[model samples]
Target chain A: MIEQFFPNVNWDTMFEATYETVYMTAISVAITAVLGILLGLLLFLTSKGNIWENRGVYAITSVLVNIFRSIPFIILIVLLIPFTRFLLDTIRGANAALPALIIGAAPFYARMVEIALREIDKGVIEAARSMGASMTTIIFKVLLAESKPALVSGITVTAIALVGYTAMAGVIGAGGLGNLAFLDGFQRSRDDVTLAATIIILLIVFVIQFIGDFFTNRLDKR
Target chain B: MITISNAKKLFKTKNGSLTAVDDVSLTIKEGEIFGVIGYSGAGKSTLIRMLNGLELPTSGTVDVNGKVISGISSGELRKARQKISMIFQHFNLLWSRTVRENISFPLEIAGVRKNTREKKVEELIKLVGLDGRGDAYPSQLSGGQKQRVGIARALANDPEVLLCDEATSALDPQTTDSILELLVDINKRLGLTIVLITHEMHVIRKICHRVAVMEEGRVVELGNVLDIFKQPKEPITKRFVQQVTEPEETKETIEHLLNDYEDGLVVKLAFVGESAEQPLITTLIRSFNINVNILQGKISHTQNGAYGTLFLHLRGDVPEVKQAVEYLEKASVGVEVITND
Candidate 1:
């Protein structure tokens, strides 16, 4: 009965596809976290009424982030092919899929990070400054530490969005569950393979959401 | 220890330029608790912020211990701020940190060693009366407890001067008193110069050695607390003084007193310092043979001495009442005849 419900579903290929998906999502999310946080901090510090506010830096960065965020993930993958080939020496497979996945998701994540940082109390920053804390100290000890829960939630949202983008990366011969569903299931009219892929993606998203909720609840002091 | 000369801060808003602090020059002596009292938007906050270089003045100089704070390098201003710690009205504590970590922040900023930081934080925890609550976060504590953490953190670097920016306005009456008492104790023990800004005159009366009444970015009146309370020069100052000294709601009580006792002379006598303890009424009745009926009276004490106001209904002839008024005036007691029938 199970074979009847999931016809021609190769278990070994499914496992390889699932591993590729997790690997691509994990690496892309990690890279986006570091780069997006830096970009977000730059945006926040250079915004008007902030301590390190600068109009020129803020305007340029703001426009770049907006331009990147407005591009759809599928088109972003196609558009970043040349840059991906330049960086990775090829524009196929999971490794080549990385640049597009990270670039497509990082700007979106940076906006979320900016919003999270903005939620921190201005008084807390002032208090840190009044204590003679250096700019580095204030950034790490006050701004980042104070807004940890919000930042964690933002990361979770960005990670889930990356899952969708990684699935889209399968369009250009990137090997993941999405590739399995697109090449073998959708093109060959195998509904069982497509159903299995959908189930696995939902499971991954659920796990990410659960972990995000757990940390947010545990870390929130306010 | 601190001097502000012609310090002004002009903020350019969307409408136009708004003067937050204007040509305010004042000196705060060492080991004295000075207060700046003003209503909201009177620039008292901006004035106190300039002392610590948190808000730099537009054109003038702010000198703390002979260091020119305004327009100095950021690093130099930060170093100067370490010697001049500040506590805020909202406490401004790091919500994510425990009480101990919050107090240890400045010590950490100064790069004190781990063991030394622990010992100092322990001592400060006890000093602020937090005791076993050091492991608690700010969200778990009451308003008073959060302010105690603020106080302990401000004292972490053993600052020579403490700037309190509306430190007790957010607290209730009882909490405000406890915090005021703590400030007084800290002032005495460390001889730390505290410059506090508040809209409450009672706060000024409780601990401030000297006060400057600010209005519309200007120090309208400035004097010792005792002198300011006893003889308020400005109209706004008199209203503030009346809040503390005249407890029975000054205007309505006087109206009621005048309504009831319209036959005899209703004299309002103000007493300050030693005059508050004098037996002027007894001497007048004994010597002048006039009957005295006390109407309404309230006496309050400031840091300096006793200050009070009393309404007396003297049933006597015109000449005798005139003589009693003259006697009070000669004795340095302020006499104001409210209603003379």
Candidate 2:
């Protein structure tokens, strides 16, 4: 009876699709987290009042983030199809969709990172400078360490946003849980499968929220 | 020793050019606990900031032990700063770092090895009397403990000069005393030249060997504490001294006292530096053969020595009143006569 209403609800198919979704989301999220944060830091460092303040670098990064952020995620996926095929020799599956997801999420994540870093205590920077710390030491040792709680909170925000974006990746044959839900449930009229995917996503969100809150509270001195 | 000659610092803010530290020249001798006392916005802090090149002078020279600090390159400036440590009013220790780690930061930046750094941190922890609390984060400590950690951290580089910019202003009076005693002990044991900037005259009296009183970005009175205290020249300096011990009784109070004993004369006397009040008061009555009715008195001991003030209502012949004033003046009592109208 279950198989009849939801033909794709077979345990092997469901687990495999869930595994694929986790794998794709994890890889893209990890990639975006690193590159996005570094880019965000660059934007921050090159802006006014930062250690490496540079107008030209700041203007360039500002424009790039703005341009990328303006483009709709769905449009970005379609627009990258040609480049995706060129890079990976395929535009119809998970591998092709991975780069597009990373590029799209990176800018969003970068913005979040910049906001988080900017929120660090100004007094911390003053203390670091009066200690006669080097510019590099102030950035890596003083700044990054001091902004850890904010960075963790930013990561949680980025990770949850990436999950939503990953669901949209179903458009390009990225066989995650979203693609399974859309293709086998929505398109093929399977209500039970759709309900199951929605429940699973909620569980994922709850886990992310729990871990993020714990780290934030632990690191905060105030 | 530190020598600042014609030192001037001008900052260009949104309001246009503002002279933070005007052409202020002064010398701070080695091993002396020198003080800079001024009201807020008096450039006392700016003058201290210039000494370590934290705020570079717009013109003139700041020579700390023969090296011109204001002209040094950025790298050299960093090295100079390590040699001239500073503690701030807010106790600027890194909140992310533990107390021990904060103390070890300067040593780490100076490239001291890990084991040596650990040993130095341990010594500093003990030196500041924060031995077991070394592992505590800054938030876990009270304001006084936080400043103690600041002192230990500033001493990490073994700097010859320690600049304290309102280090105790944020603390209560009792905490300020303990902190001042700690600085005195550090000065004696480490032979560290301390330049303390404060608005509190009592603070200057308690610990400063030498003091310069600044008003409106100018040093109006400068001398060893006793010289400034016993014979203050400027009105501002007089006003500062008045905060702790008034050298004269108010006219209204003297008038109120004189209503009953209208036959006597009113007089105020200041005693400073090794002038024992007991002997001086006893001698005044004995030598002049006069009755001195003490109206009000406060004896204070400054860093240099004992000093105080006494307001007296003298009942005697006019000739004897003159003798009593002259006698106290000869004893360096800084006598001032008050007549009720």
Candidate 3:
């Protein structure tokens, strides 16, 4: 009964593809969250009127983040191929897709993180400083803690975008649901296979959004 | 105790340099509520921020509790800041944290143990009059309650000096009075030196032992709250004193009274300190042969003493009125003849 409506759908391959997509999105999103936050903090701290105001450092970081964020995701993946090969020794598998996926999403997420940090009340940071909080403490306890809801929602948006990037990476031989849809479904004229992969990807996106919204709502005391 | 000697703060903007605080020198004694009163951008905020090194002076020194705040290293400054806490106009409590957690933040920053932090937080919650609401978020609290949380947070590390940067300006009149009372209570109970900056003269009159009036980045007038109210030399200081001393309709009422009673001389009398407590009005009625008609009066109680102004219409023979004026002048009260002009 299950196979009647979708005769061309290979459940085992579909499961493997789904796992690969989830694995890539998960690893890349985790790394992106960390790297993005660090970069964002640097950007925010060095900007005008911030704690560590430095015009030169702020300009350089701002330029770099802007450049990376402006590049098209597919073009970013292609440009990072050589760097990915050097880092991972090959650029074909899910593991190889990570470098490009993170590099593409981190700058985007870094801007989001910077916006989140900016949304925090300046008085809160000043109050923490007046309390003798060190730079590290302000970063972790005040800035990060105060902006937790924003940061969570920001990474959620970034995570969903990363899922799409993973599928695009699959088009370039990084095996995922995208790879199954393109190589086995599209190239082979299997509409059922493409439909199944699309349904699963939508499900993954829905789950990511559900989890993100949950934490965002739970964390936002404001 | 804090001493700001010849302190100056200048900000370099894109257009030019702006002097926020200019060569201001003052000493705040221990266990006293010192207030800096000024309109916005008059450098009062910059002046208070200098106490905790939140804003470093362009030159000169700020000495707080024996530590030179201006000349200290960042590490040393941070260490010194642990003993100098500040609350803000916005009641800047971290919304992510509950009242209890917010109060515990400074203790956490001071590296207190978890058990001690918890105990200190509970004590502060009670101290700020937010006992049952300790678990509530800042957003759940009213403006007054949020400020209480801010005060509790400032008191967490047992700071020797508490700086209030327009702390009660965000609150309503009733809430402002409550917060001011709490500040006075803290100053007396903990013996904490409080340095507060406000545009409201009522705040200074209520809690401050000493008041400094700032105008255009300079300390225009500095004296005891009662003295400043009694004899405000500077124009800005006089304006501030009038805020609490005279109501908006006092001038109109005086003019109206002047027109209504053409035969009497309307005189404005200022009573300060012990003289305010004296029965001068009753004495004038008994000693002088004149019709003493009280027009309007207001008394403001400062931490030092009471300062008030009374308007009276003295009617009778011109010579008798003259005698009454002389008699009133002989007393400690300040006498001024009010004319239609």
Candidates 1 onward: DockQ, in order? 0.84, 0.50, 0.91
lDDT of each residue in B1-341, candidate 3, tens digit only = 78889999999999999999999999999998999999999999888989988899999899999999999898999999999999999998899999888998888888999998888888888898997998899999999999999999888888999999999998999999999999999989999999999999999999999999999999989988888888899988989988998899988998998888788799999998888889898889998889998878988888998888999989999999999999999997999999997
Error of 3 at B14 (Å): 2.1
lDDT, candidates in the order shown: 0.90, 0.84, 0.92
**lDDT of candidate 2 over A1-222, digit per residue (tens):** 766765657667777777777777788888998888898889988989777899999999989988888899889888888889899998766666788888888888888788877887665666666667788887788777777788888888878877777778875687777887899878988878887777777788788889999999999875
Pitting candidate 2 against candidate 3, the one with the higher lDDT is 3
Residue-level error in angstroms, candidate 1, position B230: 0.8
Query: Is candidate 2 or 3 superior in DockQ?
Result: 3
Error of 3 at A164 (Å): 0.9
Candidate 2: residue B42 lDDT (0-100) = 89
Worst lDDT run of 10 residues, candidate 2 chain B, spans B246-255
Is candidate 1 or 3 superior in DockQ? 3
**CAPRI-style grade of the A/B interface in model 3:** high
| Native-referenced Cα lDDT, model 1 | 0.90
Write one digit per residue (lDDT tens) for candidate 1, span A1-222: 878889789878988999999999999999999889999999999999998899999999999999999998888888888898899899989999999888887888888888988998898898889888999999999988988998899999999988888888997889899999999889999989999888999999999999999999999999
| TM of chain B, each | 0.96, 0.94, 0.98
